[model samples]
Target: MWLILNIVVVFWMLIGVLCLQVPPSEFWPAGFVAFSLPVPLVLNFLFLIYWALRRSWLLVLPFAGLILGWTYYARLFAINLGQEIPKEAKTLQVLSFNTHIFNAYDGKQRTASGVSEEMVDWIATHPADVFCLQEFYNNRNTGGYNTAKRIGVRHNKEMYFSIGEFGRKYGDIGIAIFSKHPIIDKGAIHFTKKESINRGVWADIVLEGDTIRIYAVHLQSMSIRAADIENTYSAIGNEESFKKESRNLARRLKRGFIARAVQVEQLLEHVRKSPYPVIVCGDFNDIPFSYTYNQLAAELQNSFVQAGNGIGSTYNGILPFLRIDNQFHSEGLKAYNYETHYEMGLSDHFPISATYVLEPKPEEER
Candidate 1:
C-alpha cells in the first residue's frame, strides 16, 4: 500500500507538470481544475522531499523536475524593474477592484459606513487611470446611487458596468470599468449563474495614440459554505481540510470549478478576437497555484509574479497567503514596478497596481 501511494504520488506530480502547459488565457475552460491544482502540487512536493532523503532519488525525477523547473522559471520570470523606457508612458495606470460589494474590510471595522469613508478618501487620493470593480451596486429607481458614476464623478473618469446576478441597470450585480481615458467600448462575458456569478468586462481605451483592449475581471469566487469553511481548517489554523469530509467537499467544489473553467474559456474567446494588445487585471479569487490564474495568464505576463514581492494574496479577509489578485499584460508590455496595497482598510482583496513600459513590438515577433 505504501509503495502504491508513492507510485500514485509520481503520477500526481506528472499531472502538475502537464498543467504547466495551460497558460493564463481568457479561454480558461478548465473549471475546478484551477481550484484543485494545488493538491497535486503539494502532494508531490512532500513525497519527493521525503523520498530524496531516503536514497530514492530515481523515483523523485518528475516532481524534482517540477520543483527545479519552477525555480528556473521564477528566476527567469523576475520582472526588470529598472529598465529604461524610450519615453514617459502614454501608458495607462489601470486598477482592478472587487470592492466586495463594498462589504470588505481592513481588520477591525466591518465594511460599512466607517470603512466607506476611508475608501472614498483613498479613491479621491489615488485615482487610477482606469478602474475595474466587481460586486458593485446601483439602484436609481429605489433611491439608490450608481457607485460607478459616483466614483467617476469623484475621480473624473468614464464608467461602464454590467449587471450580473443580483442587481439591475448596471446597479449591483456585475463587474464595472472606470477609465480616465475615453472608453471606446465596454461589456461583460457571463458564466453559469446557477450557484455563483462569473463575468469579465472589456474596455477599449485610446492610449499611446492607439486603441488598447483592457479586461477587468472577477472569476467565480470559490464557493465556501459555513460548513465548508469550518471543515477546511483545523484548530491550528493551517489549511488542513477534514479528512472525513474531503471527498464530498471536493465534489461540491468541483462543480464551482467547472463553472469557472467555462467562464475562462468565454473570456479567452472574447480576448482573442480583439484587434489590439490587451491588459487584464482582477480579483480572480483563486490562488497563484490554481488553474484559473495559469489559464488566464498563459498568453499574458503576470504582474504579481513579475514585479511583486512575497505572495500577493488579494483576499486578505480569509486565507491571506493565497496570492489571487493580479495585473496581467500583453506580451508586448513589460512591468517595471508592482505593489499590492496591503495597507488600506478598504476591500477584502489587496489593491494591485503596476507601472509598465511598452516593449516595442519587433517585426518578427509582431
Candidate 2:
C-alpha cells in the first residue's frame, strides 16, 4: 500500500512535467486535454492506493487535481468557445497543405514519390469544394505537370495559381487554389521571407450562389532543424556537451521567434484587408502560443478546435503529436466538418480540410 501510494504520486509529478512543453496557445482545449489526459488514469491508481492505505480522505487529491487542471485552462476555453450558434447555410469544403521543399515526401526520400497521385486520390475521397497546395513543383521540364493542375484536371475544377519565386533555379515555391466554384478575381501576397517561402494566395470563390474570399498560405518556417529537435533529448552521453548544444538551440529559437513574429504580422495584415468574409488555412510552422499562431488566429477562429472532436494535428508525417496545420475563418462561416488527412503517406506536413456553412453577411460593417 505504501509503495503504491508513492508510485501514483510519482506518476502525477511526471505528467505535470510533460505539460510544460506544449505552447501556451493550446493551453486551452487542445493543450489542456494534452496536459490533462493522464490525470484520470493517475487518479485511478491513487484511488486503489487509498483503499489499501485506509485514507479515503486522500481522494481529495484527485478531485483537487481536476479542479486545478480546469482552472488552469478555463479562461482560454471560455474565450475560444462559441456562444452564439452559427446559422445553417449551404456548406463548402476546402483542403490545404504545404508539400514541403522537395515536392516529394512519404518516407521515400529523394526518389520520385507518387505524391501527386496520392494527393489526387485523397482529394477524390474527401471531396473539398476548394483545394490549396504549396511548395509546388513541375515535372521533367522543371515546370512540367504541376500537382495542382493535375488535381484540378482530375476533378474537372478550375485551377487558380498565383505564382511566387517561379522560373528560378530551385525557388519555384507557389500557391495553388482549385475550386468547383467559379474563381473570380485572384491575387497573391508576397511576404518578406529570407527563407524563400512561397507567398499567400487569395481567390474570390463563388460558392452556393455566394462569393467568399479564401486565402491559403505557407508562412515562413520556424527555420528549426532536425538536429535542434533531436538535441532536446536529455544529455545522455556527455552532460556538459549536451548543455552547450542545448544553449545553441535556445539562441536559434530566439532568432526564429523574431522572424516568425514579423512574418505573422505581415500575414495578419493581409487577412484583415480581405474585402469579404474569409477562410484561412495553412501550415503555420509554429506552435499555438507563439506570436505566429496568436497573431494569425486572433479574430479568425480555429476550425479544428471548433468542429474537430479530438486533437486535430495536421503535420502528420513528421511527428504525430504536433498540431501545426490550422484552419481559421470569419464569424459568418462555421466549420461543420474538420479533419486531418493523417494517412496520405506523402509530404512531411499533413493536409487539413474543412467544410464550412456561410451565414448571411452581417448588416453592421464591411
Candidate 3:
C-alpha cells in the first residue's frame, strides 16, 4: 500500500511539472489536467501529515513534490512580513477592481441605495493615482450611470474605456481606466472571437516627465450562468443530473481557459513591444498558477507577491482562496504597500491597490 501511494505521489508531481509549462492548445484533456495542479499541492500536504503520523519513510516523496513545485506555491501565497513600506513623491498608487456591473442592479441584492453609489463614494475618498475597473457599467438610463465620466469629473482625472463586444450594443459593461496625469493616447484591442467579452485597453499617461503605458484588461470569463450554478447545487445528490451539470460547467471553464490563452498571447506581445514601461491591471478571471497568469506575467513583478500579505485573495466568492485579479508592472517600476480591500462587499471581487515608484534612469542615458 505504501509503495502504491508513493507511486501516486510521483505521478502527481509529474502532473504539476507538466502544468508549469504551457499545455497543448488543441487538447482539452491536457488543459483539464493542468487545471488540477492546485489539487495535488493540497494532497501533498495531507500525505505529508499522514506519513508523519505513521513515522514512514514515504514522507520524502510528498516533500520532494512540494520542493519541485515551489514556484507555484510562491505565486499562490506569500508572507511579506516586516517589509519596509516605501513612501516617496515618486510613488504612484494604483487601484484595480471588477465591479461586477454594480450588483445593486442585479435585483437579487438590492441595497437601500445601490452598489454604484457606494463604489463612487469609495473612489472619491480612497485616492489612487490610477484606477482600472473591469465589468464596468455606463448605463444611460436613470440619468446615465457613467462611472468614468462621473468619477473623472469629481476627481479631475483623465478617463478612457473600451466597451466590451456586448457593450457595443448595450452601451454598458466594459473595462475603464482613469489616471490623474494627462492621457496622451488610448486604444483597445478586441479579441478575435465574435462573442468574446474579453478585451484590453491601453492608455499612455504622462507622469512627472515620464510616459507609462497602462493596460486594463478583462479576459475571457467562464460564463457560468446563475441558473447553471443553481442547478449544479440543487442536483448534488442526484448523480445523473449532477453529471450533466458538471459536464456543462466543465465545458464552459475549458473554453474560457483556451480562449484566454489565445487572447493573452496577443496582449503580451503588444506589451513587450511598448515604447514606455507598462503596468497591466484587471480581472484576469484566472488563478496565479494557471498558464494565463504565467504567460502574461513573464518578466513583470506581481504587486501581490512583492508587497501583499496573507493569501492575498482578491476574489469574494464561494472559493475565497482564489486570486484572479492582479497588478503587474515592468522592471523599471517597483510596487509597494500592496493591499486587497476585503471590506468592500459591493462586488464579487475585492479591490486591490498598490503604491509604485519608477526607478531612475542610468546616467549614460541622460
Candidate 4:
C-alpha cells in the first residue's frame, strides 16, 4: 500500500514537471495543471519526511522527484545570502505595480477614492528611477484625479501610456511608464485580443551613457467578475453556486492562459527588435509556473529568481500566494536587491521593485 501511494505521488510530480515544457495551446489542461506545481513539491517533502520517520529506503522516490523538479522549485522561491546592493552610479531602481484602477470602479458604479492619492504619496517616499503601472487611471479634472499626472508630478518624471480602447470613460485605461530619465522614444503595442487591459508600452530612456528600453505590459486578466468573486466567498457551502462559480473561474483562467500566450509572442517579437538594453516589468496576470512565464523566462533573466529571497508573492487578493507581478531584463543588464513592497495595500496587487546595473562590456567589445 505504501509503495503504491508513493509511486502515484512521484508520478504526479513528474506530470507537474511536464507542465513546465508543454505550452498551453498544445494541451489546455496543462495551463490549469501548472498552477499546482508547488503542491507536488510540498507533498513530496512531506512524503520524504514520512519515509524517513519509518527508516524506509523508499524515500528515494520522493527525493528523486525533488531533484528532477528542482528548476521549477527554484523559480518559485530563492534564498540569496551574499546579494549586495549596487553603488549609486551603477544602480537603476525600477518599480512595477498593477493599481487595479485605484479600486475606483466597483462594477457599474464609479466613485472617487483616495487610493490614488495614497499611491502617489507612497511612490514619493519610496523613490525609484522608473515606475511601470498597469490598469492606470488618468482622469484630469473631470473625475477629480489624474493618477498618471499626479504620479508624474510627485516623482518629477515623464509619463507614457498605452491608452486603452475605452478611452477617457474610466480614466485613460491602460499601462504607463514613469521615468526619471529623459525618454527619447516611446510606443505601444495594441493587442488584437479585445481585453480592456491587455496592452504593452515601451519607453527608450537615455541614462548616463546608454539607452535602456523599459516595457510596461498588462496581459489578459482572468476576467473573473466581481459578482463571481463575491459569490464564491459569500455563497460558500452552497454546492450548486460554488460549483458554478468555480467553473466560471476555471473558464476565465483557461482563456487568460491562451490569450496571454498570444500576447507574449508579440512581446517577444518586440523584445527581439530592441536596439537598446531592455528591462521589462509589469503585472503578468499569470503565475511563475505558467507557459506565459516560461516563454518570457527563456528570453530574459527574471529579477525575482536572481535577487529575491523566500516566496516572493505579489498578488494581494484572496490567494496572496500568487506572484503574478514580475520584473525581467535583457542579457546586457543585471538585477539586484529585488523586493516586493507590501507596505501599502492600496490595490489588489502589491508593487515590486528591483535595482539594476549595466553589465560591463567585454574588453574586446570596448
On TM-score, who's better, 1 or 3? 3
Give a tens-digit lDDT track for model 2, residues 49-120: 665477676556555554555522221222333334355557888888776643543354443344365555
- Sorted on TM-score, best first, the list reads 4, 3, 1, 2
Q: What does the lDDT read for residue 16 in candidate 2? A: 47
Model 3, position 336, has a per-residue lDDT of 81
- Model 1, span 309-341: residue lDDT tens: 655566766554666677888766777557767
Computed on alpha carbons, the lDDT of every model, listed in order, comes to 0.63, 0.64, 0.78, 0.82
Best by lDDT: 4
User: What's the true lDDT of residue 64 in model 4?
Assistant: 90
The true-versus-predicted C-alpha distance at residue 158 of model 1, in Å, is 0.7
- Who is ahead in lDDT, 1 or 3? 3
TM-score of each: 0.75, 0.70, 0.89, 0.91
Please give the distance, in angstroms, between residue 126's alpha carbon in candidate 2 and its true position after superposition. 4.0
RMSD of each: 5.9, 7.1, 3.2, 2.5
Off by over 4 Å in 3: 52-57, 87-89, 104-115, 140-144, 165-171, 193-197, 364-366
- The candidate with the higher TM-score, 2 or 3, is 3
lDDT of 2 at 45: 48
